[model samples]
Target: MKLDKVNWENYYDKIKGRSPRPLLRAALELEKETSRPNGRFAIDLGCGDGTDTLFLLENGWQVLAIDAEPVALERLLAQVPTDLTKNLQTEVAQFEQLTLPPAQLIHASLSLPFCHPDSFPSLWQKIEASLVENGRFAGNLFGVNDSWAVNAHMNFHTKQSVEALFANFAIDYFDEEDKPGRSTAGSKHWHIFTIIARKMSDSSN
Candidate 1:
């Protein structure tokens, strides 16, 4: 079966009021376990309508919320409270064009798979390099068995590839989901890997 083409603008509208993704929540919880200060920087990749970005700001983090869509940033800024205005910054950029900065946390939810296959490796490398020692990375990756795997523009991975990507990190949370689901794009089967892991401060950890 052919996967329905995504209309991203409408998809953003459909999820406007949704909570932050579980991977992000897990990352936050793990970060708290470190007893670290709350003022660290975080990058919210493909931040869409900025729910995760806002969550970061609310918890005293300085946030850089990046998305390729201007409308998405506009909607996010519109919803931000007046007091939080200072803690948030936004960039309009695609994953392929991403140049991340050193950060304590980097999050992308339901976004990375949309990156073109040709650019995914470099993008992943950038993510790995930009994270500070012990910095956390949280996100979802589409598995090879996903219904959307046939879409040539999107990237999908085998479990081995996903595990390889986090080899240097101590994985904190991982849940593989393969099931039927409905999305704003359409009805489909989902094969997803939800991950939250921290960069190893020393290779030993």
Candidate 2:
């Protein structure tokens, strides 16, 4: 799908009020085990409607929520509780143009797959470089077998490719689903990888 303005707007409208993604929940649990400070920094890429953004804020994390669609931001701001709004900052931008900052967590949800294929590698590099040692990344990536894989505009990876992408990290949770199932947008035949990985400690060579 092209995912133009209309498509994104429709998507936001359809998925409004949804709960945080399971991958994000698992990542948060891993973070809790480390007993970090009360307020950690997170970047929510393609944070449509702020579902996970709200959850992060409620958990005392400062969030920088980025989305390409203005409507998504408007809906997200509207849904956030006023008390937690102070902890949230939003950016209206596309993945190709995003400049990531060092953060404790980077939650992409179903967003990264939407990045343009030609730009995905560079974006992925930025994502990797922006994380502090041990920072976690929780997100979904489309598999080559997915129906949308033929789009050419979007990025899809084989299992090996996906695994290679996490070479510098330790996979805490990796669930691959390849079957005929309806998507959140009511589309069928979904093939996705839900991943939660923590960056490994650096070893000076």
Candidate 3:
């Protein structure tokens, strides 16, 4: 399938009932080990239909859910339980123009790869800077061999490149998958990286 030809509306509908991404689940479990209090905040980049945002809000995190599509934000807001609405904030912004706030967790799922390549470095820098020291980042990135890698607008990385992006992070979990898979778009060869890393303190860095 051509990356440019994906039908995002259909894709969103397809994943509306899916479970939260494993990267998010792992990050939550690992962060819980620190015994940090709840009511902390998270930024859900590319929140889509709010599947993950709903999970975070239910878990007691104040969430700022962002997506480039207004419809995506609408879907997210609609699914949020009424009692959980106070803890939720929604934003419609593109990665290139986004301004991030400090957060205990930055969860992106499989969204970051769609960032225009020219903007991705700056966007990543923002992500890193917005995280509090010892804060966690849970996300997926497209690998160099991903079928969609040929799309000039998307960012794909080598293992070395991905590791280099985490130089200031204390990585606790890193896994790669090169297999056949189905995405919201369609069936394709997936070369992906799943990461759970904690930002290190200035002195530690």
Q: Specify the highest-TM-score model's number.
A: 3
What residue runs in model 2 are displaced by over 4 Å at the alpha carbon?
Answer: 1-6, 37-39, 184-187, 202-205
Per-model TM-score on C-alpha atoms: 0.93, 0.92, 0.94
Best by lDDT: 3
Q: Which residue pairs show backbone clashes in model 2? A: none
How far off is model 2, as Cα RMSD? 2.3
Order of quality (TM-score): 3, 1, 2
User: lDDT of all the models against the reference?
Assistant: 0.86, 0.85, 0.88
Residue lDDT tens for model 2, 1-205: 3333347777766776677888888888888886455348999999987888989998889999999988888888987898888888999999999898788899999899989999998998888887778888899999988887767778999899999989999899998999987765566667899999988864311
* Candidate 3: regions farther than 4 A off: 35-39, 203-205
What is the C-alpha lDDT profile of model 3 across 106-147, one tens digit per residue? 999989999999999999989999888888899999998898
Q: For all the candidates, what are their Cα RMSDs to the real structure?
A: 2.4, 2.3, 1.9
lDDT of 1 by residue, 33-147 (tens): 7754534899999898888888888888889999989888998898889999898899999999988888888999989999999999999988988888888889999998899
- Positional deviation of residue 147's Cα in model 2 after best superposition, in angstroms: 0.6
